[model samples]
Target: MESAVEQLLHSGTIIPAHPLALDQYRRLNENRQRLLTRYYIASGVGGVAVGVHTTQFAIRRPDINLLEPVLRIAAEEIAAAGLERPFIKVAGICGPTEQALAEARLALKYGYHIGLLSLGGLTAHTEAELLAHVRAVADVIPVFGFYLQPSVGGRILSYEFWEQFVEIPGVKAIKTAPFNRYQTLDVVRAVASSSRRNNIALYTGNDDNIVADLLTTYRFHVNGEIVEKGFAGGLLGHWSVWTEKVTGLFGRIKNCILEDYKGAGALLQEGIAVTDMNAAIFDPSHAFRGSIAGIHEVLRRQGLLEGTWCLEDHEVLSPGQTAEIDRVTAAYPHLTDDIFVKEFLSQDSIKKLLLHA
Candidate 1:
């Protein structure tokens, strides 16, 4: 890993899985997409993950062919920002080995810092086959392993799979989003046992358990030594909405760790509040059928998106989901970044930021 990239990853920061911005026709909305990128950069996110689950996997369809375009837009925006510090850019790579390698190369072409490799769709492969696929992609660019929850299109990867995963020299980080505690522990312990344990950063993808994951230290007895690990930060769909607040929350969590704060009571309460908001936005009542749309709805409500449009017409919010969003927005107004977004949009230099040079 490049020194800067390695430093940032280990230090931990908020990385929102960038969402797709589409017109009513379900075509890419370049202007709004650019604006969304500016919003994230302005909101203090350390990085952005494009072409990921929140961006909609359907965009890769030949007829749509949005993978490169979306990646390019984000790359342009980040470059245009010209931040003095390193800003990690993560491009999501999916599909079988051949396609995953192609996407990894494409990500490197666009100046992405890492490829967030999703093994969700390859359900039939054996663990050995899966590891081979992972190694093939990592051979192209550094890899961020994704343990997507089975509720989505993900399969249950054994601890053995991750044990081998962390041993790969090109593996840089892992985002554990199994949404299951036991499964999350599996990934953590696997890394803990690896020779490169310190080299691989563990980021929490568990939206339901974000605060706790960030706060609790994971200790393991490995090879006659005690190893401690904790989530450095999150690469989350939940963080994609209310981003400014999300950054603030992460900073507070970081402070707790650095100060060795003993007060868990208040932080635990905040975690429940965040999880409650996630339920509303993630729409767990419908098995996450509305997950992407739920995220779009929040952005749309904040004027970050035009509408809750998705590539597939049937992918709209589940019935009663809008009401649930309404409930949470009303219930936890502090968690939303509406005011920050409003002021950001009103800035005199907004036009310059949105210009497609």
Candidate 2:
């Protein structure tokens, strides 16, 4: 079967970056010299999730006036990781138009080639005003518009609204996290088939369907021969491409899709199964338990992340659940880290340290 990795090699690219925080934003400018040097270092780059910080509901990370620190870290990390230019996603904060403009200016100053702006609190009634504000920022630096879904945050955008947004200059890519698989596929078809081409890259933020959407489906093509099957190309949920297991799989899948579609389809099914099992550890209610954190926790269980740990708010496997993950991890073998579950700390110990339940 073709893994997501294989399919990606043939169709498109993946860019990965760490989240940015207000407190750490200063590092962007201060670390510029070092980061710039490091950016050119031989690297392996994937997708980056910048702008937003993860914390338990109680405490949000600190905010900084400038985003240079975070951008510097991101550019350096992506460069070091051997990825192409890193992409940035703006985190939404309650503020006046001045604050929004400041964030846009930060993005421009830091050399972020791509941007995803989350305007959650901005109302539809103010949609025209927001677009004008976004355009003002875009004049300085390019930007992507994302209507963050209710699952993450309520509806900040609508299809009619986005149709208007796509008209803005420098509005290149969009990260769409739809309510379900069908809605996701619908959006992909719409964007890929849209009249506007160059400034728009359709990114599927819908975790469950990323593999299938990118690796199997056929969007419209000018050539009549074989409608190319596979991802519209943007970003997958964190875990889908985070670890070597999933990332490696995607790398392989990229190549396989162009050579053999059937093979890629099979690999995607397997990948989804592994992801499903991982998500199941948290709860049946939550479809995806934040992919990065989940993968980090699983890796933590096997002792791969080493001193690194899953951030707070990350759903953890309970003591009773540990044996299950251990068993599943062993059965899969693809996620192997060769550590005895017996030696590891209990779920209670892990939970207490990770975040209050």
Candidate 3:
């Protein structure tokens, strides 16, 4: 299975950390969720990740039994999509070593390719303890390190931690999303410093710096020589919302990298506009209190969501979030794939897609 993770790193592109859909019952919305998975396939993401923060993992953890059922539905839909390349499936794993190991085993049992392992919950412990915990989970499934931003329950991880983490046998990738350039570079340097440096893949989860992240390469001095590397791709929550356009941006960036279109100096040179819209959608003004809500609101307008319903009521949009969503959607109509979402929102349309598959 090491070859499987290696394969994803080598050839796979964007892997959206997809959002979870709940029915009016506040339980899993099977059909609508399946439709969302198919939409990602048609929109062109090379992989999909569920059971992450954006997928409401916290709420699902209490009733852990619910997690696998929801995941099974996603696995079913991904199998039905029938793409030319395999859509790498990533299941999120968090909590204590035992809990994370259980989830990792579940991911492997269901044919998931990797576990997006989170270390936030264990921040209170020593690095050695955390490393032991991580190794325990790695024993079950190949795990991707998730250095999430503190704004959303993620704890800060030191360079020392990452230096040792990359040495772990089953740690195959790292999703650097601390949103701090210094922290991001720490993980990059740590990976480049490792014995498995060439084998480990680094992915960006920095929604605010997506274009720049994908466009830049990192350089490091290790073992008396210079080493260079760049993010293999992304596994982002932001991509879950504006999916179609995100996929297109991915294509443009890839073309620029492949053809050496250095005439403009940087690929998608005018990508600031996308980040500007992110500023609004991500609600930087309110310390991102409305970030998740903003994404839900955007999906609501596209008819993908019935309303902005989160697992917890307080998690709903903050005041004025809707206006921000409205402003961004109108300001950059091209960024919203509402038309594409609406086209398949109908039950009949999804049925046809499934029938063909």
- Candidates' TM-scores? 0.97, 0.65, 0.92
lDDT of 1 by residue, 1-357 (tens): 568877999899999999999988888889889898999999999999999999999989999999999999999999999898878999999999989988999999999989999998898999999999999998999999999999998989888999999999999999999999999999999999999999999999998999999998999999899999989999999999999999888888888877886566688888999999999889889999899999999998887888999998778899999999999899889888899999998886775644542
Writing each residue's lDDT as its tens digit, candidate 3 over 1-357 gives: 646446866554888777767766677666667777888888888888888777776555565346787678789888876766657888988888878888888888778988999887676889889899989888888888889889777877789999999999888889998989999999999998889887788899887888888888788888799999889898887888879888887887877778765533544454676777777667777887777767777777776766677676666777777776777778878877877776665558776644533
**Who is ahead in TM-score, 2 or 3?**
3
Poorly placed runs, candidate 2 (over 4 Å): 1-11, 17-43, 53-68, 77-97, 123-126, 218-234, 240-242, 277-296, 299-328, 335-357
* Per-residue lDDT of candidate 2, residues 242-338 (tens digit): 2345445656666676686758757777767655565544333544444334444554444323321333434444335545555666567764423
Lowest lDDT sum, 10 consecutive residues, model 2, at 20-29
How well does model 3 score by local distance difference test? 0.79
> For model 2, what is the alpha-carbon lDDT of residue 258?
62
Top candidate, metric lDDT = 1
Error of 1 at 191 (Å): 0.5
In candidate 1, which residue pairs get closer than 3 Å at backbone N, Cα or C atoms, i.e. clash?
none
> How does candidate 1 fare on TM-score?
0.97
Model 3 clash number: 0
